[model samples]
Target: MIPRHFKLLLLGAAICAPIFSSAQKIKAPLPNWQNLDLKADGQFGISTEKAYNELLKGKKHVPVVVAVLDAGVDIKHEDLKKIMWVNPKETAANTTDDDKNGYADDVHGWSFLGSAKGSIQYDNLELVRQIRLGQAKFADPKNIAPTDKEAYKAYQKMVAELQGKIDKAKESSNNMLNVALKFNSMVSKMGSRNPSKKQFADYSPEDPAETQLQKIALENWGTGDFNNFMEEEIYGAMKHYREQLDYHFNINFDSRDTVGDNYADVNERNYGTGDAAGPAPDHGSHVAGIIAAVRDNDLGIKGVADDVAIMSVRTVPNGDERDKDVANAIRYAAANGAKVINMSFGKGYSSNKTAVDDAVKFAMSKDVLIVHSAGNDGKDNDKEPGFPNKFYEDKSGEAAAWIEIGASGYIDDETLAAPFSNYGKNTVDVYAPGVKINSTMPGSKYKEQDGTSMSAPVVSGLAALIRSYYPKLTALQVKEILMKSAVKVDHKVTVKNGDGKRKVLFSDICQTGGIVNAYEALKLAATY
Candidate 1:
């Protein structure tokens, strides 16, 4: 699954362009809105500031370790460096496995997608791979056995969906490239790379062909500022579509060769290198910052909790994360004393869900909380399954420690729910502020992102807060406290349903019927 943050940004670029003068600086909508109290500011925030001020004031807290399972975390981030979970038993820069945990020099954490050569950046979806592998079985239904009837049916559905995606990708790629070429040709005629709409329009047209091209460019690129839109937006979209058509949908490309792991084996662990920070670190860095960016640094925004040790477990890549890596990541988090695990990546298919489920159970047994994103597909999660979910296809319960989260927004109006967030009355547990969330990025920088990926870590940070202060509470108890203490909304809200808006009760989107409140949860934890 692609990181939800980038998807939101790209989606925004397609619809709107920022119109502002260089002289007039636009003030950012408060960077710490997610930490504000709803009653005080009329925003759908988690009241993190209130929690620290009232409940956690002068209280002693234990240091809780939180594991971030995503692409990769920048361990050396300025605000995050000091809070990284260091392996006390393992020696850094040593060739030997000092701790004897079947990993070498894993000082910060481990990477299941890394090897001596490099990290994997692209892979075909499991559904695409399955279709390629079972082409014979799908080609003729009569060849399938009675017991294999159900599997054959599943293959048919997967093939249909894959074909649709491929067709859509090809069409979009062709359309974007054509428009970009026309736009670039106009820019060349104007003799400037960053051409204003007025400049292009005011210029004399050479022929009927030039007039037609300029008309199309003006309609798509807008009649205002055109800074970075051509390169970052148009070119970016083209690159994504090209990659989708070439790599993600290509059955011939095997991404597993980079990791040197057997694709068929799920039990194999301890096969990857110790490069916790994989090829891409932006996604995981943002996630880590949301969970535990240092407070009082006066440089960037403070995290939900001040006292926490972040454990980095790199597993996710540019494409769908493999099941074997996910299972091992969970086991590593549980075994290494990580009390809370934040899993912000998800896909539509699962190859070996049982292995992942068993690992989830193992983490639950160790009393580790798992906070997962409900996904960014803007659909009901109760109907559609996302991998690493709370339950398998059979509906057997996985873990009590698990918390499924949908994305919320700072605005408290009809658009409270994030337009792209996936929600479900039965599947999702609670909602949290996720839109325009400012957090850490790579190179010790900060950026605002939007996604349930951001929302999941907000809850993970709250889980770490509870576990830190209320050390006696089990993972399940912490989950119950968080859900029971959420701030319930009383009115219905309008959410994006495909291209149109639909009015839905806030309670109908999630089981909690409320936005998570860190202050309320901590207050409830004090009673127990």
Candidate 2:
């Protein structure tokens, strides 16, 4: 589970009333449009196919390892199994630390959210954790020490924000329940669980109550099969809101005991199990697929890089990821020979940012490139930077091998930038095809997701592609080539600015002011 705002953006649809049915027929874009070129296919994409055909044709490339640091990954998925990184020293399920790297049976990768018993599926948000700790430390706000004044002030603000979130979650959950009940009643009256749009429109009520339900359905849903709208969307939103109250915003909720690690020890790295594919592998699997899912398999969608191995490093949970786990995951990946790392998860706060920064420096020292999502808050990253970013907490220096990616759509007009994608002229490095990106899911399934989560992997895949063909180029050089070789978009594009949309030149919002192009980057890589 990402932040609520990020999850909503990844869903690619609003969960509020007057919800539009995904079942509504609409003309779909060309299959694998993210790899198609704008000039050749009339779709705004990264031109991956063109790169493979023209630039990388018949090229003997080394296998580049891309570490996917997210919730988890489906290592057994048809499209991903063949390309998963296997630990050469550690054997699978033998309960032995063959590699002697403090991890046992890490055949694929490691799961920082797991333990010898099981894995954590959900956890409290960072805000909740902060409040929980603050309330204990500063029980008497009036007797705060002079040095604790600022900490107490921030705690008070967090308390207020947590209250607001609780209220909103309760209201949304109630609304969903009411809407679900009404839809169920309407279905009961119709004597059909799966009624067509015409059937719903032609419904005749036998009583005033039923008539009122019919009117509400028509007003909220408009048209389409009510079952899918109610079951998938409504119930899903209801569950999300319920989780927000039960886990995310709940100060008493603590799942750290399951992991059996010292909660206060930010430097502890010898904990967790080797189950990289935890209880929830959907998000990570999709991200891995976007990066490298066996391109020539012809089973699912083709990934951006053909000769790459995906290393699963499970760090994120259903709620906000802890900075300690993120730090450990980065170190683990960098030490395990990952040339590129994709971090598709982020939060607004970090409890131990220094640990993460140190880990980032370690990765940098190892010449590994990290690609991170710019976030889905639609806010300027310059104003509200995401956690575990390139900037070190102490501001000594920034990571040279970092790429911040924003989401873009498959369009060349004003809608090119994804409305939910976060951007900044000095923060976001480039944009990538993210809207309606189809990728591999858990259980050998596939899904089309939207968000900067999807976009970051696009850039990561490109980085892996460059690293595969030109292993001599440094991570910083690859980052520069990717940014400088982006396809410049001079026209203005519509973007979300608070509650309203605004049109701005693409160059004004991001450093490159353009979307990433694989063809151009590969061409530049050859020159390097």
Query: Looking at candidate 2, what is the lDDT of residue 12?
Result: 24
Best by TM-score: 2
Estimate, for each residue in 318-417, the C-alpha lDDT of model 1 and write its tens digit.
Answer: 7788888899999999998999999999998888888999899899889899999999888888788788788754577567889999998887877788
lDDT of 1 at 43: 69
RMSD of each: 4.9, 3.6
Q: Estimated TM-score per prediction?
A: 0.88, 0.92
Clashes of 1: 0
Best by lDDT: 2
Candidate 2, 1-528: lDDT as tens digits: 345334432332332345433333324568898999999999998999999888887888999999999988998999999999999999889889998998999999999997987999999889899899998999987789999999998999999999998998887777667757766777787788788767887987775545555554554452246775565456767788888888899888999899999979997899999898999898899999999888887799999999888999999998999999999999999999999999998888889999999999999999999999988878898888878789998989999999999999887888889878899999999999988788999999887778899999999999999999999999999999999999999899988888888999999889999999999999898897
On a 0 to 1 TM-score scale, where does candidate 2 land against the true structure? 0.92
